[model samples]
Target: MGVDIGLEKFLATSDGVLVKPPQFFKTLQGKLKSLQRRLSRKQKRSKNYEKQRLKVARLHHKIDNRRKDFHFKQAHALCDAGDLVFMEDLDYRVSAKGMFGKHLLDAAFGQFRTIVKYVCWKRGKFFAEVDARGTSQKCPECGGEVKKDLSVRIHDCPHCGYKTDRDVADGQNIRNRGIKLMSTVGQTGMETACADELPGVGLTLPRQVSQPRKGKTRKPKK
Candidate 1:
């Protein structure tokens, strides 16, 4: 499984499934502001004031709990299904400094990453983090380039004529890259063992045999 973290939606998987973002904080912001205003009008240090103050705190706690519950459910579901899970090691600090800083913070990408890593570890599934730099910009189908900015939600690849939701393309790229890395590792291990068992077999390397494909994902290379 490859997970591409996003601000709009919580996650988009390589398989084209999307996990809709639960905008807990954004949804409750107005109510919180109203509670704060109400609390401000109450006499300072009085019983009524204390009660209103606790109400505000409780709202905050509720938001936190809901966000956490969503994360855990997502992480558990992903970890339970995939044999290997990969994601980009995105820097939330940098993301949080940009125009959508508040939105990103409310989404809490860091918290989700931690939960996913632990859940995968606890479930005995392989977990890997790859460089996120070009995953979003590359076309997963044809290994072609597709330049896009943050505002571009749909990816129209000029090179391969491929089209997809941007986050899904990113997730697909991450999964492809992870599989390539694992192939390299597996080949390295096999070369050593095969060389010892059979002398001449080490000279020629076999191609990366792929299964017969029916999906658009694994198009034959151009």
Candidate 2:
């Protein structure tokens, strides 16, 4: 599956699935702001100030934890949906400096992509990052350039008459690029390793090997 991360939605997959952004920080923004106000009003180094400071810190931590948890769950879900997953290789930091920086930072596209890669590795699934240029501007069907502004949410290809949601088309284009890349360069060592460990390769491990363990567990002595 090809996944296109965007501002409007958290992501859109080539399979026509759209995952909405949870915006964890945004949801708690007002409360967080109030906490910060209360903390700022308290005298420095005082007991009440320290308590309020901790409250602010805890809210930040809560947002971080929620975002991380969401990323892990979505990553596993993506792995379950496809054996091979592809995403854009663009640097999200550059985009985060733009006008929608706050929203982009809240969405945390880079972190989610990293989690997805890790989940794919843990699950013995194939994962690759493809060139991101023109993903949203090109036609997935005809491979022709179909230019449009950011405001344009739908992809309309005049050459091939292909039409679809802009982000979904981007996902398909990413998928196409990944397939081409794989065909041209063949599988990387990582992909080959993953393939070898999967069922069809005549190698099998315990079910727990492919599934993430829940809660905390102590490591056994060697």
Q: Which candidate is the best by lDDT?
A: 2
lDDT of 1: 0.89
- Per-model TM-score versus the true fold: 0.81, 0.83
lDDT of every predicted structure (CA atoms): 0.89, 0.92
Q: List residue ranges in candidate 1 displaced over 4 A.
A: 191-222
The parts of candidate 2 lying over 4 Å away from their true place are: 187-222
User: How big is the positional error of residue 37 in model 2, measured in Å on the Cα after superposition?
Assistant: 0.5
Name the weakest run of 10 consecutive residues (lDDT summed) in model 1: 202-211
The 10 consecutive residues of candidate 2 with the worst lDDT sum are 184-193
Error of 2 at 141 (Å): 1.0
> In candidate 1, which residue pairs get closer than 3 Å at backbone N, Cα or C atoms, i.e. clash?
none
Give the per-residue lDDT of model 2 (tens digit) for 110-198: 99999999999999999999999889889999999999998999999999899999999999999999999988766565677688767
